[model samples]
Target: MNRALPWIIALLISLTANGVMTGIVLHRVAGSPHVSDVVRHEHRHPPRDPSDAARTGGFNVRAFLRSLPEEQQQIARQRFASERVGFRELMLAAQNAQQDAEAALRADPYDPQAAAEALGELRARRFEIEAAMEAIVLELVADLPPEERMNALAAGRRRPGGFGRRGDRRPSPRDRF
Candidate 1:
């Protein structure tokens, strides 16, 4: 035990020194620059402008797209591209309606009637756009095989978490929402 004693003490001291050096290096690096900004965790969807987000209404249809076979996906893309003008028009109409509503509200004295009319128009535009999107979705899937359609539907219900069994282990945050 005496022969090993000095070696053990030296080993412990070396380990302590190495640990202290490592901690100092970590502290210095963490404090040296914009570490928090640089070390951010990856997110599926990074922050985006509210207006840009409004384009999709938080409806992620990628599940359905990815579930489709390659040929079908190409067809769907072409179909969506063809409807680009319609989507753009709907977006512009909705944006203009919102702007009109805000302008009416900010008028010398708020014009409740004008604001209400603008909001009503906005709502209608949103519904119209939603319907158009639904139609496009239907068009995209119409040619898909039954199994593929089922896969896409499955993907759609699994965004935040799978809309699986009622007796699931735990409720997802989306469930609370």
Candidate 2:
């Protein structure tokens, strides 16, 4: 019995260390938010401004349109209607590609190639959408007076993480213009 005493103690110590590490890892995994929860939350509480102009990254065209006189707004709408339809179609395609990429990433077998291709397509779609938005913004701003054009351009140039680390708190001083 004396010969086995040290071996048994070593085994017990190893098991205890492993159990502690496993528990820590499991606790962290359980505490983190699930992907679906985030998506659901976003869907449940959509952004206040539903316009595509607000959603796109640059040149707050919608705000500029809002600032215009009623007659000008109608002219702007007419100028934008055809382009808007194309932009909407592109956005829909990008959204679908995003879904496909997510599915590929989460598949049981997890085919990396499939995920890569889906992500590539998603990226291309995003580029196309961004280019379209830029073109639209440029076209809209071309006819604007200098002061209004500057205001429209300035509205889109915001700090990336306006909310900082904590969403509930206000943005940091650096984020404010």
Candidate 3:
């Protein structure tokens, strides 16, 4: 009986360990209630690319425009030719304007009036660049076929989430309330 007792105890311990592992696997696979919280936390403060802010601030508008469809590119070329306002030229002008503002600010950082004027000029140039890019995008998007436009919209809508699908989930803590 004493020998059998040791075997029985060992079997019970092994069974308990297996049960715990199985429960964890099942919890993860079954979409535990806390999965959404985990997902939200993981995405709450997503890492920002350093260039993203600058790109958004109109620095990359010309490159973005250049990457559009061939027809759109041609249209932009024609428009630029007519108006003598090429995207690259506009980008360079914006860059020069921003550099000038920065230089002015650096030269007289203590002067509030000069700083304000420089800042205002920088803002205006950024706005102008953004507006030009937006106009170009609108014109190009308008020229796309209806089906392609719908598909592009759909693609943009589905681009945000990193999860495999709506039904995907993650494991939760055992004491989840």
Candidate 4:
């Protein structure tokens, strides 16, 4: 019983430590300002310029291209054309990996090993695609005039998918004002 007694005491100590940490985290979370309060605070002080949204986060290449003047657009298009084929190929591979992962997960025998391998491949493919996308965005941003770069990057702050709030087209900076 001596050996078991030491183990039981260790378990009790671990549990107590975990409980204290959890309570501390919960208390901090409860004391934090609510999301609505933060939103209200922000709304009280609007951006000086609507284009400020682009400087903050999210990058939609299509929207960025459309915002450029015709001459700049032509330059950007030439740069993008060379990369688009590889980007599309990467995207297709990622999609196929996703399908394979899904199929592995749904297999009749339910092989955990196979599912894990498929998921790993899907993750790697996704990482490749994301890297390719970041490369394209960075190159484009570098090529853009300083004044327009932020707007290009900030295209998707309020929503996901980078296109817009509802997966539709994103409104240009002009459309906001």
Candidate 5:
């Protein structure tokens, strides 16, 4: 027992060190740089008050649909009402499922076969969630008035552009040259 004490101490130290290193690496890798930017930008450019929508001719699906050609508006209203889950909710569910699977894998890293099976199930569930989201969005957008559909597409594009006008601003001729 006395001779084994040193080996036991070494094993504990190595395990503790490995756990700390793994935590640090995981935090860095999982941190969302884009989400931080979006939060910062929102603070800087606070959205117009909800009440201002009427005056600003801002895009509001319900309002836009009400104003669209009656037939188109009716279809859009029906489509919008029929959607089961919003895009954001579906994405969140998929992410949660993935995180749960990762946590399970971490808890039992020694069981490769079990981990692989868990991972496969997680992936399949994620795909299903994403497909449901896509179907919802497609169903809603498909029946929307053409103008409203265009507006929704444009709004979605605006989110990524917040990171940089890198999306729209063409490269200067000098840079190309």
Candidate 6:
């Protein structure tokens, strides 16, 4: 019993030591600036580009709303949630309209009337969707203070930089100004 007890005690001590060492290493790593930067980059939300919004099927107005006060943000979020249903329907209808228009244009012998009708349908769908989007945007910012609306607008207008991250944007020394 005595022999086994000493071994058990040693085992417990070793396990505790191992855990403490692991925690210390992790804490050091977590606190390190380079490590933190990598971690931050991993977790940070990328800024939204309005052009990408079309591909995403919805604009990220939610991200822009973060600049608003808490109460206003909540109101905006709720409005977005409600409008999403209508937005989804509009998207589907527009997609179908576009497909129909393309199919008409591709038809043999080129039925001008059919192509014109499809074009009208497609344009109507596009205008309706655009108008709906504009209405939603107007409603969203209508209650917002001008400053916040500006902030939201500015945030969305950020286009991706033309150069790659490491690519130098500055002109060469010999280049004319």
Give per-residue CA lDDT, model 2, range 11-71, as digits (tens).
Answer: 9999999999998899688897555546755446553353444454544444455555555
Task: Give the higher-lDDT candidate: 2 or 5.
Answer: 2
Q: Model 2 clash pairs? A: none
lDDT of 1 by residue, 1-177 (tens): 699999999999999999999988997888865455567647545544543434434555766676678787778778888889989999999999888878887998777898899889889988898899889889888877888888887755454433456754443353211
Q: What is the C-alpha lDDT of each candidate?
A: 0.74, 0.70, 0.62, 0.71, 0.59, 0.71
Clashes of each: 0, 0, 0, 1, 0, 0
Which ten contiguous residues of candidate 3 have the minimum total lDDT? 168-177
lDDT score of residue 59 within candidate 4? 47
Q: Candidate 3 residues 63-147, lDDT tens each? A: 4443456667677667655645565676787788788777777884377687788778778877776687667557767878877
Comparing 1 and 3 on TM-score, the stronger one: 1
Q: For candidate 4, lDDT tens digit of each residue in 11-90?
A: 99999999999988996888976565457555455434544545533445555666666766676677667777897998
Q: Which stretches of candidate 5 lie over 4 Å from their true place?
A: 1-100, 145-147, 160-177
Winner on lDDT (2 vs 6): 6
Expressed as tens digits, the lDDT of each residue in 69-167 for candidate 5 is: 556645655665455356456567667777866876788446777677778877887677657645645665676677877776555333221233555
**RMSD, each candidate, Å?**
13.9, 13.6, 13.3, 16.0, 19.8, 17.0
Candidate 5 CA-lDDT value: 0.59
The alpha-carbon deviation from the true structure for residue 16 of candidate 6, after best TM-score superposition, in angstroms, is 69
Find the 10 residues in a row with the least total lDDT in model 2.
168-177
Best by lDDT: 1
Better of 4 and 6 by TM-score: 4
For candidate 5, report its TM-score: 0.35
Off by over 4 Å in 3: 1-46, 49-89, 153-177
